[model samples]
Target: MHIHASLRFPRRLVDRRLLLSLSLAGFFVVHSTHAASFDCSKATTAIEHAICDNETLSQLDSTLNEKYQTAMANLSDEGASELRKNQRSWLKERDACNADAACLENLFNQRKSSLQATTQQAETQLDAIIASIPADPANAAYQLKQYRGPLASAWLVYLNRFEPTSGVTAEEAKQRHQVAVTALNKQNDFAASLLKDIENDPKTSKNVAVLTFLRMTIEQGRYDEVPPRPDVHCFVFSRQGDAAYRAFGALWGSSRDSQAPICPPQGNLFELPAWKQLNKILDPVMSAAYPNSGTIRYASYADWAILRLRATLSPTDFLKPIEGQSQESPEKRISEWDDKSWPKVQREQLLIAIDPARKATMEWLQTERKFTASDASKASTAIVNAWLNEQLDYLSENLSTGDQ
Candidate 1:
């Protein structure tokens, strides 16, 4: 959770030769007679200036195309076709780049509108540009039609990548809220299973508590740990146990209160009857498998692995009770609460589940082995891909079931 905030530019930008070439190309574009003769000063308004610049660039583009075509006249038909295909691909990338620039400009305008002092100035400039543009109905209609195809395609691509389209009906808005809900539920189920496993291991209760504490520390965005002791595995025990314990108390105490409605009211917070019953069943099995000090320290971890496996195989009905608690219906309890509160808890829980291993590995690599950014990055790809695949499988399965 404690992401390093080093400002890194693209590696391509850092290459001296690439930088020199870019500088020369930029200089050529800036000093070209066709580019310089645009007469931007002649236009009295922003919109007029923009239009004039675009028109001049279009002319320059046409001239360049004519020269390129003449130079390529000796090429065979197959060569010409291949060249055309490459040109078309380049054009597609250029158009997408320009569209992204326009989108950023729109976003800037929106942000400017949100401030009291800048709002009037931004609105005035926008209104002046709108008023200055001549509204030719025929041209406007044609441009509007031209815009729809790419806009629709872009929207579909975005929805498919980030949102969901699996169960959307024709009558519904393209936004798939059900898909999002189902995905979140699956993640929550996974986190809950991991938590249950840790809580259920009586023989390794101290180790489980320590791990839960370390995980909570990471979730709270803390990363101030001394290098692992020569004799100790940092993942199993940290020198800064006090910091870890404090983080655990804060995170889990708050979570227990938040989830109180879903569990039976009990006086002993750590000894919830449902969880205690599970501990009794799992403790003996764990003790038999891990009889030594070194392996016993990892008993909680093995318990978590088993829980993760069981979570994948368990029926959806196992989660139904909590599902009802999480329902978005306009019941008094939910309607009065802010929507963001519960999700923030869920995010914290998931982060806590995964953070101990990540932090320990990072600490080991950085403090012990002196890993470079590239080295750490190479190691992280496998970790990230495995997590992504697990989440994707959960999403695919739940979506297929129409679980929402």
Candidate 2:
């Protein structure tokens, strides 16, 4: 699928300021005004030094200050004074992080998570900060590593707003979801403007996460296109919980007899690299150290949305064979080679069905996915190994989720 195709977006919910700020044909970009806790030019502590050195860090700092000031405004004089004192204390701890980008990032993480934006007042105060996406590059290169937490949280709230909640009528939930789909579609359309700009610029476009985020925005946008269901479905992307180790499904929280798995959309090598980049790892970094979940890696919206869309489409695809297609297991299919009585065409068909699937995977990786020769070879070898070992049962049972 060409994920880049443009779609119609609604204008109902978008802020007017954002509408006015967009400039496509103009020579000059209108930058959003934002400010930080302290002046950037003055010689400062390690954390301040890090913030001054990087535009993203500085942007985040500006946003953080904006959030803090808003937090203070809501409080009484005594509360505001106490928060001011707390801010100074926090600044001291933050300044202690001087020059360590990772340490400074941790501070932002802690600070942002600690602050809440519940009411309209907080949202209004913080609106400009969220709206202040720097032109062309929506996500700053490398700085996305620091942003994964906050952006993911924002995206989640957006989705969860549509999810069926306890006691909400199925009809009401569907109505809300229909509304959500429209809002999400518009959000992606707006983001696509910036994304398309990045894709045109060879220098910034190659940063895979930018592409990943863009694709994710587009995929999540399929809400409008998705067919509604009777029961509430919480799409499961990973093999976790009691059903952990199985393929995808709609893990029903209320147990309403949903048998099929929900498969999220899968990203190719181009987008996957950007995702891993944002998470600060070459591979999906498992959160072994975290006390609760076995693996702490947060699945990107693209990854999960693909799974959900896949699951939503052919829910029972894994359990049943297409009527005209061969249901023969890979082991049986391969064993037919030993049969002198086996028809030549049948043998070729079986070989064609399985071998091409594997080869296509490798070819796709090397060509379409733009994998490096070494990486393609390594990945292709793994597919060959799975075939050789007749582990194709797992693949067949799971609708040929490639190189899983």
Candidate 3:
């Protein structure tokens, strides 16, 4: 079943408390004073009244709003819209707290911390994008124009009068390119840190986590900005058998321009022992889940399984060319997901029935996929790793779709 992209899972109260404390750790450093993001005199709801009444809660509101505004300043129109939607969702949750000071504080702190991280990351990206451009006034001017986003508006305005034909020294551009590459490499290193969080609990990590990590790699190429290609090979290769190896490969594997010398020599990934083993595990489950063939088969959960796996499989797997496979190209395969008619009723029934085949898969996910085998043998470890990835795919298929 195709999952909705916006599904959110319930988080533990301890998670919220921990987040609140962490967010508040640096709170006083910037926000020692108290004020609400809005006018207290105009406070309407119980949630708003609570924030207006409590000094700490008012400060938290003001702090998050400040960070939110800054983040909005840096984002593209589309990004801003997404952030706004998320904030609205957060507001709904916050209002649900209704006069609970602790709940309001926790939610406010979490939002504040998230906004700060986003703004900082966007600032770093904008800086790198600026540095990546050739020092040639015209080239910079023209490239800056393409940005059109709020993040690049200042640079565009500053360089607006320059003619496209004007030139700068190649040596200067080379130095800037080197700096840009270094900045991007650092960004990748930061991404590695995020990957480490998932690696620490790969088996337990949610579908949202996996999908977010994969989405991060979607813009890896950015070749138009920096042609040298920032080296993410070390980032992925170092984490082999872990989530990073697979997540980082999603985009790099598909982009023809990304098959560069920066990575190890390529081989057909599907033929790899680990990949074949994963396929082996999935084959039966998918077959049992969707026994029918033809038109209905095209819309089966099995189809989504293939798409999700390809999306998360390591680039090393996709690096090698397929020999005698189905004639459908990758482009067509991606488009198929959106175009095919969804068999919602049959899918709903399948979810409700919980047949032996489905139960077995769930049992595997809950048990073996939770941790490596006790012996920790190389083969056992490989199988466990394969199972972990399969769990991620399974979670992606069902959890996000609310079919659980």
Q: 1-404, model 3: which lDDT tens digit per residue?
A: 22221211123433654586788878867755457889887888887889988999998888888788767655656677888899899888988896899988888888888997787676565555555443455655455444334325433422221223434334533443343334334445443343335435544344334433333433333322433434322332333323332233322111221332223323332344544554554444445444233233322233233333332333223223322122332222222332123244433333333232323333333344342333223223232333333333443343322121
TM-score comparison, 2 vs 3, better candidate:
3
Runs off by more than 4 Å, candidate 3: 1-34, 135-151, 163-404
lDDT of each: 0.31, 0.38, 0.44
| TM agreement with the true structure for every prediction | 0.15, 0.24, 0.32
Q: Compared with the true structure, what per-residue lDDT tens digits does model 2 show for residues 183-278?
A: 434544544444334335454323232323323332342222224221112222221211211212111111211222233334352234322332
Which residue pairs does candidate 1 place in steric collision? none
Order by lDDT, highest first: 3, 2, 1
Per-residue CA lDDT of model 1 for 116-197, tens digit only, reads 2222332233223222223332332222222212122222222232234222232332332232223223434333333444
From the highest TM-score down, the ranking of the candidates is: 3, 2, 1
- Model 1 worst lDDT window (10 residues): 1-10
Highest lDDT against the true fold, candidate: 3
Q: List the residue pairs that clash in candidate 3.
A: 269-317
Runs in model 1 lying further than 4 Å from the true structure: 1-13, 18-22, 35-347, 351-385, 388-404
